[model samples]
Target: MGLSSPTEIVATDKVEVAFKNLDAAILVGSMPRREGMERKDLLKANMAIFETQGTALEKYAKKAVKVLVVGNPANTNCLIAMKSAPSIPKENFSCLTRLDHNRARSQVAMRCNVPATHVKNVIIWGDHLSKQYPDVHHCKVNVSGGEVACFDAVKDEAWLKGDFITNKSWKIVEGLPIDDFSKAKMEATATELIDERDTAMEFLAKK
Candidate 1:
């Protein structure tokens, strides 16, 4: 028997282990082949890509793999992909909300004069884009290890309805020239990572 025979078996077993341990998958799409796109339009474009990817996963990957859609119009894109692959559970698909959550946490921490860690169980719900509802209603911030309801007194219905929505929702336009060309150029460094790695596949395949 060859000395390397057992090593081959171990390598194969590790592959199986990796496939087994995969809990969920994330799918990202390249830029849609369109201009002047709305959220719905963007979602429509990405859905075509996600649909294919979702089908591939259902056919080739492990059963019961959760899917997270990181592309724009994420929630709708997720829904479209989920529908495309009926074999994969619908609940298994979701959109990324961590960015909004982080932003909210940072804002809250700054407002309340507490470290970000002091914020407990911050829930970011609904559509991942501008339409998302950052419900700080249930969130509690710790000050000196004391828990306090952050949004308890914010009962002004008119202000909450109009002002909050207007302030929270904004258009994030990139590729615009700001005075700080150095910072913008530095930001462009992310393109290399995008070039090298399939971030969508990595997220989906990660344990």
Candidate 2:
């Protein structure tokens, strides 16, 4: 290995060792599912894992550590980890939204027949879960004809407002809206990491 490499990989299977003295904790890997495991069982199983990880972070990691949970049911896992680490500031804990963030942009880009880069101001509102919403009310598409509203370009509420996963039972979930407009836009759209796209799979398959 080059001595000047910016980062080094110190792979380990020990959770205690991994959660300690870190600048940032990204809990992305999930425990492999067992046969006949129900959905709730799976959630509980991961919850236990994150709970332990969170406790360790509190006890040993820097008080300023930032955490991002990206495992399955990331929102719940995010909640479990945040609640577990009381000493750690609440704002420091978050779930991965890049997947969904890019998705909302892609959908807008496709609908407008432009590159994904042309889509802007799209926000993923609500908990980063299946029921999480992709809000485009404020989204803008940079078409040749200057900028156009996403709704005007797509013109299909059915395509834009599609079914997503997870229960919307909690008063709080991923992507909380900051205002009445955002709140309504959040309510209007509905979603999940569950990007099964071949490119996403390829990235996950990499070391």
Candidate 3:
């Protein structure tokens, strides 16, 4: 037994035309956040996009379909999508915060001089924006014998709360090669990160 053939590729800006029988939907489209723009500034601009997508997903996608919103101002965008898709279960919709999660993990690993894989439970709290908190207070990392608290390994609270957590997710995207700053490249990068995080989650679920 092999898996079935691929589904049809519907390329359309119209959400009604594209969403149909989807088992999982990853929303990576939204208006880009410009310099000096706050997350709330994007709320009105991106709300319509998520509303249309949400409505389409509600009507067309499988009832159990999982939705991961990767758009800018993701937390609020996800809230709009969820509200728009009232027919779908609330738990099925989530904002993609894994990029922040991975950033925290990598920073911890680098500080501890261990591979990123050795880090775990670097919790990301609040929104997916700059104000979000990446708390490693209860996180653990692999050691010679077993695992130990990440905070214990790196006691520099000022660095963790200030530079480590705040510098990565949004800034890294802004620092992408100027030529590669198009919508396509940014969407592709977000999609790749979502895929990687999903794979890791699936692996952990099985374990």
Candidate 4:
């Protein structure tokens, strides 16, 4: 994957004066979740920070600048950022789905007893946090002899349907079968996103 620049600007509040005409903006700064903080709390805390950065991007960054939100609560934060920047095309915005992708990849790799590089095609569905679903049904691993379906390797039906860590890189993956359990998880993720969007709009209204 083509990685973004390491020149990170920690000063989210100073985006206006710090730079201009940016080609790609990797908004990685976020508040850490302290002891006993819920995911919703984390999401609410980062909303204002991303809102400011998104506004700055709209005013100063290039029209086609690709914005990647790498913080926790990334999906909701990305939504807030994208909504804040009306001029920037929505397709130009995204969140940290790579973590979900990599997490799924690692789990599959460990299951197959192969290096992570040997695993591919693990799909992360919906949000980037608790609501995310890592679908390995279509995944494959490069075993000693040859490649095999991830399910053939794991062979644990109950574990396959169990909870695991998550992203939504939906373009490269499509048309896969979704069982009832998977559907429920994906729907829950979507509902959570909708709630977050509504809350974000309300928060923005007060600003």
Best by lDDT: 4
Off by over 4 Å in 2: 1-5, 31-37, 127-130, 162-207
What residue pairs clash in candidate 4, if any at all? Answer: none
| Candidate 4: regions farther than 4 A off | 1-13, 38-40, 163-174
lDDT of 2 by residue, 164-186 (tens): 22212112345644667556555
Better of 1 and 2 by TM-score: 2
Q: How accurate is candidate 3 locally (lDDT)?
A: 0.69
| Cα deviation of 172, candidate 3, in Å | 28
For candidate 3, the 10 contiguous residues with the lowest summed lDDT are: 169-178
State candidate 1's TM-score. 0.60
Q: Residue 11 in candidate 3 has what lDDT?
A: 60
Query: For model 3, how does the per-residue alpha-carbon lDDT over 63-179 read when each residue is reduced to its tens digit?
Result: 898898998667667777787788899988878777788888998988989899999866565555444666676689997658998867777767865688566622212342333
lDDT by residue (101-191, candidate 4, tens digit) is: 8878887777667899998887776765566677777788888868889888777766667744421232344677888877887788888
Clash counts per candidate, in order, are 2, 7, 0, 0
After TM-score superposition, the amount by which residue 126's alpha carbon in candidate 2 deviates from its true location, in angstroms, is: 3.3
Best by TM-score: 4
In Å, residue 197's CA in model 3 sits off its true spot by 26
RMSD of 4: 4.2
Q: What TM-score, computed on C-alpha atoms, does each candidate reach?
A: 0.60, 0.70, 0.71, 0.83
